[model samples]
Target chain A: MNVPLLQVRNLTHSFLEGEEKVHALRGVSFNANQGEITSIIGPSGCGKSTLMYLLGLLDQPDSGEIIINNNSISKLNEIQKTQLRNEKIGFIFQFHFLIKELSARENVALPAIKKGEDSEDALERADQILNQLGLSEKLDRFANKLSGGEQQRVAIARALINSPSLILADEPTGNLDTANSEIVFDLLQRLSREQNLAVLLVTHNNQLARRCDRFISMNDGLIVD
Target chain B: MTMSLIGIIFGISFFIVTQAQTSGFQTYFIRTILGTNGAIRISDRFQDMKGTVNKISKDGQFKFQFKSREDAEYIDGVDYPGKIRNALSEFPSINGISEVFECNAALQTKSRNYSVQAHGIRINDHMIASEIENQLMHGSIENFLSDEMGIFIGNRVAERLNLHVNDRVNIVGKKGNFQLRVSGIFETGVSEIDKKRIYISLATARSIEGKRFGGSVFQLSMFNPDNARSVASQIQQTLGHRTVSWQEREKVWLDVFKALRISSAITVSTILLLSGLGMFNVFAIMVIEKTRDVAILRSIGFEPKDISAIFLWQGMIVLIAGIVGGVLFGVIGTYLVSQIPLEIRGIFTTDSFVVNWDISHYIWAILIATIFVSIASWIPARRASKVEPAKIIRETI
Candidate 1:
């Protein structure tokens, strides 16, 4: 009977791909709550990642309402939406999009700094997250110097630096080996249960999706189960 | 970026240095004219009040004032000398005023005779009257003041008449022959003054000419020569006499300077325009290289305006550097130009050319160039801000 941390209702999206109207998402609806991890699994073009992007405020929904922390942000401007994203939402991508020139600490600290946190405080916060993520010695190491698994962990540390309530991760472990993938997945799971954070995971790994607290089955731009 | 910066520097320096030379030339000529002819000259030229400047160009049409003591045709004099002196004293800008009389004379040496202009002045108040003493190539002011019949001759006159200090010469004026001694010789670097102009005591000028030809007029100097026009206009309004400022005496020369400045400005602005274009091109390329970083930043909560600010700040760095470098280079270039000893001399006697180093020009250049560079930078910054993070994220997937 508890209120959900993120609310979505009737999301529909389409795009013009070479003059053909491709419906990426259609009448999709979902909810995520605090302290829970959910997975979205489907074939290659079933709009799993598209739903995650819409939830993250990275793209506009064609006609839908997205509510984060009880605030309906569908009418917010770009600046307001960005502020809301920085304050309440975090994202993890498949490619570990860390800036190569920045060290692990700087990359993690960037989002906190963007939210107008004091830099010394932001870096200190980054250090705390990085250390807990087992990157204590990699604070000063540039993104390129870290291994693929290490870089993914650094990306996770960056996502958690601002202490957002909801994390939308699209295949956070898709590029890792079984051991590294398990390590990264275990961290995400621990964050959800321990911090009471809502997580939406878009993945191709059915086994990993089955292991989450709950999972959604998507097919042909709609949730089938 | 470096090329654009360099272009900005070159344009500003070239404009300032080139304009400095022409500005200096005008200043130098004005100084010479004011030194010898006084800052303002007042003559009872006509009885009209308003059309003085326009009426001056029309010669022989003016009705003479004071008609010569009922026949004072040759006398062009200030009506009340004491009232004029008191009125001039009320003006703090007026430094000093002297009465002057000039007459034509034919001077005969043993070998040749040369026609000359004799300027007569009071021996005591010689402030503005004898300002060119520094140009004395031979003889001295003290020597010129030693005798009652002493004369100051120009260097070219001395050269032609073979006259030196203590030499005797015969002057044929309206009254006939009179004797005088050459006490000094000066070269003013002005051919007209050095060739035929001579100076003598006021008493001697009257005795030699039998008081027939020369008429007294007021020659006033000012504390600041730049205020000469305003002060002269005010005086003319009160006294109703024709007053001529040094600027008015040399309008044709100043017009030549105006032409030179316009040409220099046109040449230099082309360079600055090219720099602005180069800046646009440079930042456009920079945005391309930083597009991925922009996408990442955009996706992670940074506002579009914040991304634009990053690129604009980079452009501002180049703009500031260019302005400082340009001004410094211009000063050095102008100094180098001022160093070359001018081989030929005419109105200005100095060995080197003159340069005006007022700071206002530098400030003006900075302001104008800042607008140019900022707009150039904004185009690219706007492009950077509009980067589509969703499109890039889709591509990566």
Candidate 2:
């Protein structure tokens, strides 16, 4: 009975939209375990990104308990949340937000550098990770020169550089064409399986969602299935 | 960023070089002028009766047309030296005073007659200790005290007459021709003084002028030369004589130097102010343009302080480079400025430009640049730090 990698209990959130309180989430609860990919599918305004933001410790929930590694996060301040975000979680976005000026390897090394690792060691680790992801030849290419699939793979390498237990990827393949989407999905699947890491992916692609180990569907901010 | 660095470099170099040159020129000009001119001079009113007669009438012509009559003769000098010497104690800044007799005479050599202005100074009165000491090229003022017939000749006059220390020359005075020995030769740097002036003992001047009491002028030196005007005014009121300060005697040159000082200050200040503003503009635009990157950096676990440091380091890099480059360029510019030959001919003289190599100016430039650049950079850095990562990431990114 190992502790769950990420836990959310009775999560709720709202926003002020034109003088009206719009509830985004209501009592949404779930657990993502280690070594499993959890797929969350929803349409626009379904609060999937909001849930991702909350679970990543990017925003505090209106009412809920988020526990990472069995340590409660509801009471953490911004500094503590930043430290936790740096050490315990990884993030990937739909657009593959890599700094365009940096090389692929340097992009991957940033998180490790921010975590107080020596730059040389961080860069060496980045080189190893990029090599493992089959970007060995393209390690020195700037992010803008890489194709959609290559850029997304580089983002995955950056996310794995710090060795976090859980990854929150919001629509990781939303902008990719079908062939490249399949290739990136396959790569994520292989990496998740091989690394024994948990991934909570928010997406609208049902075919890819069904490939995950666990599925959670949402509409209007509430869990449907 | 490069523009900002350039601005700072020019600003700092301009400040240092301008101040150094200004100080040097001012010192040189003041020394040249004060070498021959006393800080304050009290000369007897030679034209009092003549001026009154002309002012009361029109051009000394009494419209009343007085019939021919005899007039009493009057001497044109201070006949009471003891009375004036007692009045000088009222000046708090007075350091030394000497009576000088001035008259136009012809220096008669074997085959030449050169008209020269003779200044008769007391060699033992300590007046030459400061004023003439800077201009002494050969022999000493004490030579005049030892030899009653000794005279100090200007280097130019010496060159003209082929005269040296212990050489004898005859001067044709008002009533008689007196033979004199050259005791010392001084070069006052000004062409007027070096070419036409000579110094003799006051006792000899009185004997030649047939006076038993006083000379025409009382030359006074002060510990602080800047106190001349006020001291002149006070003494003029108390002693009833025509008093003149060195500032008034060379008003044109002094006013020009003051204007130069003011213009240099304004120019340097404007340059530094604009440089600081340029730095501010550069960093502000940098922060604004990098909004998306700020969000991305924040999302990657960079705190507000770290983000701010990125911008601060950028500004500091420019500042450090600018300071070092500016100082190097300033020293070189100062040296180059010093090499330029100056051709000023009238009151002041210098062969090449003088540059005061002052270390304090360099320290001052660095300190002021640091303050300006830090303020210019800090505002933008604080702005960068307060950037809301969530808003930019969600909306803009």
Candidate 3:
């Protein structure tokens, strides 16, 4: 196989709940290759979200290694991790967590701005991406003013603004209706193929998983398939 | 945020008004004292010895006289007043100089007798000697000067003796008892000065105290009274006389002014501190409310420092707004307070509430507000920065 865009080896994570240590992830391994939309589907409490977080670098694995674009990032400091996330990885959560105070374009441009890109240029890029996602009219609208579908589209525009090699999305269409979900899933797949990007999707929608380039199933904190 | 701004406004306004009132009283008190004592005074003991010897030689042997002190005590006077004036004239700070003969004597009326301080000032330089000319409540300094036996008594002293302008009083000195008339009764609002001081002519003072009394001192007014100490030191170095500044002469009053300033500072600081605490609570709540947003930003690639900076900028914006509003309201409040005609009579008398438009105080108030707001914001910003994206995301999911 071609060198994967993102690779995770023996990822483990645990949480302490009322003095009981519950294993959220147990030595889970996964690879997401360029030009492919890889979907991870499982039932609730199956550690799919936990693995996605570890791969996204939002949470540190207890014992594992995450290599992105051929560079090991597991040993990187928090600042380096944030920089890598800014420059190389993108995230789309289920809730479309856009800052309510900012406009849709500003929300999209935030990651690029944080990466020290010129604000005007970042905003211009954000406007172009948002337009491509059919959100041109909502560019100046505040996040809270937009509908659920429009907000998720803005989140997708934000995830694509930095043009990261790997996009880690956790239930990006979870809060959307069937029409919006199909539209978003189609857009992600198209972007993955056209831009040669690795798209990792964590979801409970098996029908959507079956349409991806590759699919992995998880249960009891382990990859079952 | 509104509460914080209001607190800052009230604190700064109170501070500005208090400073203005206290400074007004101090300025009035100092001016009154300077009117009588001058900005700087050179004692007679440091007078030129050679000039005294020449006077003794020209006038023959003079009788030794002790006024208020013991018989063995000797009181010297300024023998070369012109020489001292000429020497001080070279200094740019020296505005004007006057000669004065001061002594202790008993003022006896028909009903009551009191020991009083007598200042015999040059009629030509009386305005330069003290502000007594402007302080005359009953009669003019010209009337006091034209009458050879005329004396300017304080209002309290006049009240004590039931004396009025043109009233004759017995002034008994070591040389002889002289009958003097009160030509002017002045009120400086200083208890010590109003109760005990009386001004007479230099020639009359000399006659009453005998030939032993030359000009007892050289009183000087400076262009900037605040520079009196340095100028006095310079005069001492150049003229070989012991010089005293107005501040040094009124040490007790200056101490009182210092206490007033300290108390005002404490009050203003406490107010600002409470304002800061109020801001801290508001920012803390904002941080808590914006936790999910903070996590979202972190997930979008913001570093911890960047997260902190966003919240800090928010706090700084609020602080700037509060500072601008506070300053405007403070100035307005001070102006309003000044417009109210309130006479303050304490150790001194202030005709009206005076507001000093000193720019430094306003700048200090702004600086204090900025520091307090910064501290208030930093705590919440730090806490906000430490929020974990994973924890928030998991909780929400």
Candidate 4:
């Protein structure tokens, strides 16, 4: 736990269309410690999501360095990148994009199944996580059949099924009502502390941001606070 | 993915069954023809030998010398007492006989210069002429046998010479010859025979060839159609002479059908290509549609190639199902087609029945189907592998 879970230094990302280059994030720097819920807050289109993408190893920064669990990720090949993502990081999105065809339990077990995990063991673990999220009764329900709040919870259960060291959530409660949002935020908070896992959530919800262990604010593609 | 797999099965079933039926028909056609015609024909090495001979030619066409004065007699109306009796004594179970006397005859045209065949035949033999009689466009065998100097001419010759029945035609041979009457005009269906063959009696043929007292050219027919080849071989072995079956004489037809096989493969491959494209398109669309879900999958520890493998597995299932269905349908359809009544409308000589089934067709269909479907799945599978979990997750967020 002495080493930082995610360390980003002087990261920059840009998008090119025809001849014009638009910068999405510039010199964005942060360190996320283990066993803490860290929140990144900014106005719409202020690169908070970009920062999360970079931290999640989804996109390659034009110029920067990233260290996750003491391993340099920027120099890793595609296969290595995929392995790191699969083993060490979990992501939750604003929209609960669960596969409509699979049941809640099956959806959660999908990652382990893809990783060549034993099907029966994956299923048992998926059930345990779903039960922890109070979704044991809904284990066999399809994603689309679940209510929005239940679907969000299933997504969270799926994220934790892999037991990743770092959970990167981009606006995890952005789509929920205030009550559902509070419920989701409280779950995130409890899971982060109980599991001793580092959690990075990008959101505009000030109330949820205020509850996090640390607050990082962004504006105009730069970290301001 | 399962639904698409089912569709592939349905489509391939249609293709395989139709192909099998066509293959069955082709095999049957060849076998029936070969069964009736024998597998090979061994004849005298002389290439100029044509038709049956009722009379002995003084031109020394035969290698053996005559032993009696009866071998040189000119009987105006007589069956081949020598070869027919000899062949009967040799192979008793031989059921039918046909004689073709090679002679030159002049049609009673304006110029009297047209080339004429005078293929002499016995009118009463039903079994020997059944195949040929069925091909007759006009007239009957009785019409020619009841009259003297009667003849059966091909339809084309009848048209070209403007000749009809009972027309007096002068036939002159190198030796003892006579004038004959054209009793009936027959169509052989074959263009060459229709243009040139002239049917006459064995008696007139003997006088024209001046071999009346000797023997006619030997063509042995058997009771069991399947035994034609064995009988021909036995005749060859016993007589130490050569014989020829229609199959050996008409092998060019076999060559034409052999060429058709290439076209058949090309046709099946083209269909497989279209089916593969359809499969790839479906996979590509599915991946795009489930982008966000795929992102969720990646976040949960599924690698990019694992995502691709899922679609690949789905494609393989589709192809296998389709091929199995297609083969089943093809076999059933081939059976149905074999039950169809084949109609032969004109005078021709062939075995009408064909029983065709071969293992090669099934093997080829399976091999080609698998290869085609795999190639089809390759492109879309690659595209699926390129999906970045981070991009997907970021987009959804």
Local distance difference test, each candidate: 0.83, 0.82, 0.83, 0.69
Best by lDDT: 3
Top of the candidates by TM-score: 1
Error of 3 at B374 (Å): 1.4
User: Per-residue lDDT of A1-225 in model 1, one digit per residue for the tens?
Assistant: 445888888999888889899899998888888888899999998988888778888888999889887889877988899987887888899988899999999999999999999999999999999999999999999999999999999999988988899998999999999999999999999999888899998888889999998789999889899
Pairs of residues at least 3 apart in sequence or in different chains that clash in candidate 2 = none
DockQ of 4: 0.41
Better of 2 and 3 by lDDT: 3
Q: For residues B1-397, could you state the per-residue lDDT of candidate 2 as single tens digits?
A: 7777898899889888998898788777777776577778887643333323222465676454221111323445565766776778566798777778887778988979998998877875535424686577887867877898988888989999998888899987786679999888998878888899988887677666666566568878788888888988778656757778888888987788878867896788678778889989988998998887787777778888988899889879888998999899999999999999987655666788888899977887787788888888999999998887665666752
CAPRI-style grade of the A/B interface in model 2? acceptable
lDDT of 2 at B173: 73
DockQ of each: 0.67, 0.32, 0.69, 0.41
Candidate 2 wrong stretches, greater than 4 Å: A10-23, A60-63, A186-196, B33-128, B131-134, B137-146, B155-178, B190-197, B202-259
lDDT of 1 by residue, B1-397 (tens): 8899999998888877877877777777777777778888877644433322323325667554331212113226566666777887798998868777777898998898899998777645555543757767777777777887888888888988889988999888877677898878877767789889888887777777787433567788888989888998888767766677877766777688788877777777778888999999989998998888888888789999999999899989988898889999989999999998875466656678788776766776677678789999999999999988877787776
How should the candidates be ordered by TM-score, best one leading? 1, 3, 2, 4
Q: Per-candidate interface C-alpha RMSD? A: 1.0, 1.5, 0.8, 2.2
Question: How close to the true structure is residue B378 of candidate 4, measured as C-alpha lDDT?
Answer: 66
Ranking by lDDT: 3, 1, 2, 4
Candidate 2, residue B375: Cα displacement in angstroms equals: 3.7
Query: Model 2, residue B221: what's the lDDT?
Result: 78
Which candidate, 2 or 4, has the higher DockQ? Answer: 4
The total of clashing pairs for model 2 equals: 0
Tens digit of per-residue lDDT, candidate 2, span A180-223: 88987887788777877889999899999999988999999899
